[model samples]
Target: MFAFFTRSIAAKLLVVTGVAIGLVLFLSNLVLISQTRDRVHALTMEQADAEAKSIAREVAGDIGELASAARTMAGVIGRGHEGQSFDRQGITNILKANLEQNPFAFGSWMAEEPGAIDGRKDDVKGQADLGANDDGIFTPYWSKDRNGAIQFSTFGAKYDAEWYALAAKSGKGAITAPYLAEGTDVPTTMSSIAYPVFSGGKMIGVSGVDISLLSLSDKLKALKPFETGRVLLVAQGQQWLVAPTDELLMKPYEEAGADALKTALSSGTGNLVPNLADANGEGFDRLLFPFAVPGVNTTWAVIIDIPHAAINAPVEAQTLMMIVGGLIVLGAVMMALFLAVRSIAQRPLHGLVGDVERMTKGDYASDVSNQDRQDEIGLVAKALDGFRHKLAESNMLAAEADAQRKAAEGERRRNEEERNQSASVQQHVVTALGSGLAQLSQGNLTYRIADEFPGE
Candidate 1:
């Protein structure tokens, strides 16, 4: 069976067909899986980035409101409290009221001396004193002390932070980067708004408000639904702000990201590290996207992992089915080809061979007939039949010619014998007459010739 399979043309064709079908199915499945991974990655990243942008905008809007309030307050308290003799209690009361009204703000306060309050007040008295500076005019209040900057013993120095510097230099609102609070150790971010207080067109003080980072983290956690997979906030080449807390964020990238990140960065969206081994050494397919955050120098990437075995199951089954189907089709084709060739070519040649065999055996009586086909074999069969008929006719004519020749030979022999006999009889008759005449002349009367001789 093995030899036949190897030698048979039909069997070889089936094997080749099966292999071709399997290869086609495998490549098609690979392309499909790769494209699917890319599409899913693109959609997921787009959604995450959009959510991030929306949150950033919301934070920006909240800071905008604080800045607007500060500007309005600064316009109201024109010119540093020179000869103003204003109601300090009423002003303080208004600032407190504003702080109560705006719950988003951790604390809202105003500072004086045009540059005295550097956002670090060691004591509550110092904070209060800064609030009521005689040489400074209250503009607007916008500042928060989440880390207890006003605490007497442990108040740390807070000067020239990014937010404070921006507010003082640009005289505008700014959002600070995320950081750990001094006393609480809780991750916090601040948004500050400062408006210049002017006395006679000369700046005297500034007002600002600070917001906490707790609300932002809460919103980040809820960026996507629970079942919608993972949502990550990564700072380019740094750390992931939000990711699955259980797994080490860097580990997945170190292992799977090696190939996936390369592909994502190079190709934008496609199969990166396909068939990557997981922590347990199981292979998985990974998809990645490079998240380009606005106003940030670093690029954030998102990766998704799916098992290779799961995706390839369908492809394997499909390949098997195609191979079997191709084999069946090949079998049918070969069978038909063989039968058609035999009937058209081989069978007619076999008939001609049979005719030759019969002729060799001297059995020329058998009729050589052929089918009504116009192909080469059929034409050959027709020619053979014609030759056979001519041979039979020639044999018959030769037999007739031989019989006539023998009959003519026998007649010629008989005619020659008769002629010779007739001549002899004539010769004898003449001689007898001659002898009788001679006897009469001799006159021997005694010896008379008997009228009826005994011998006559």
Candidate 2:
């Protein structure tokens, strides 16, 4: 193959064309694949952002339900049942109904000021004998047990706690961060909301509700980003509300790499993190989607964790396929071109070379072939045919001149022979006459008869 390509114009042209075609194919595939990867990456990022937003909205809506329920119950207490005093039985009925109506809620309670509800303070005075706190506050707590049974207990003087104090100070309801609520069969993450009750434009007590955030974790777990990516929910204080691993649940974000979310929370918007390391020091890329619970006064975000390999898997496969397919296509095209150039050009040129060789050997009787066609081969054939004719003419003239010279030499030889014969005869006659003259004096008549020589 190398020798043939080196020797033939057709093979050389095919090689050149093949190289040009290969270059074009390589460049085009490179550009197309690069653009495809970029578009795919952009599309995945965009869809990831939108998906995170949707999950954020769902969680926010769920938290809002808990806050609204707490505020509604507090409003009822402050109004006091159509301007009647809200006694202990009234509080019991309200708390039970609140728990029954809001199945998402884990518990509901009212924390009253000392002597605040029905002026009851001494009702808990004897409670110090028990393990419960003895602060004289009539705090009625209604909660569901593991079997969903409604149970009652007193909250004691937890009125000064942050949840209660924030409500009492701000005169509004707000949701707390998630915590693991123990001592239940339905143990899961729980949060609370506290709302202040006001009667006659004066502060009275605080009513609150607790909602389990297990549903949020369940929703996040069910949600798959990019088919194989993970999802998590991080609260405002860098707390992990939802995590892929249960060990990360209700823990601070530092466990999941401080470098991961560096300024994302401060930015308070959606962003991306590259090569984030977890507590195990395993790395992943994450999309941070910011959200919030209503009236929570803190930003929360849905984090979509995608593996580095996951993001590049599709493009890498495509690149491999394109490289293989491009090589195959280039080979096929080059083979076709090789066949075409050999047929259209090399074969005819081979015949012309033969004609030229035959002409060199003085074989001009046979006509040169391919002179009528219109191409380089035809042009060469025409020139070869013309040379054959000119060569034939020169040979013919040479042959005629040689024949004429031979004829002239033959005629001259015949004339010279005739002249020599006559001269010899004349000399002999003269010698005979001299001899006869001498012999006539002796025997002239016998000599003349003997010497009678030739007939012309």
Which of the numbered candidates is closest to the native, going by highest lDDT?
A: 2
On residues 337-363, what C-alpha lDDT tens digit does candidate 1 reach at each position? Answer: 667656665567677889988877766
User: In model 2, which range of ten residues has the least summed lDDT?
Assistant: 124-133
**lDDT per model vs. reference:** 0.52, 0.76
What lDDT does model 2 reach? 0.76
User: What would the TM-score be for candidate 2 when compared with the true structure?
Assistant: 0.79
- For model 1, where is the 10-residue window of minimal lDDT? 150-159
Query: lDDT, candidate 1, residue 57?
Result: 51
lDDT of 2 by residue, 384-451 (tens): 88889999999899899999999999999999999998999999887877887887778655655368
| Candidate 1 error regions (>4 Å) | 1-13, 76-86, 114-166, 174-191, 225-456
The TM-score leader among the candidates is 2
Task: Supply candidate 1's per-residue lDDT for 227.
Answer: 36
* TM-score of each model, in listed order: 0.44, 0.79
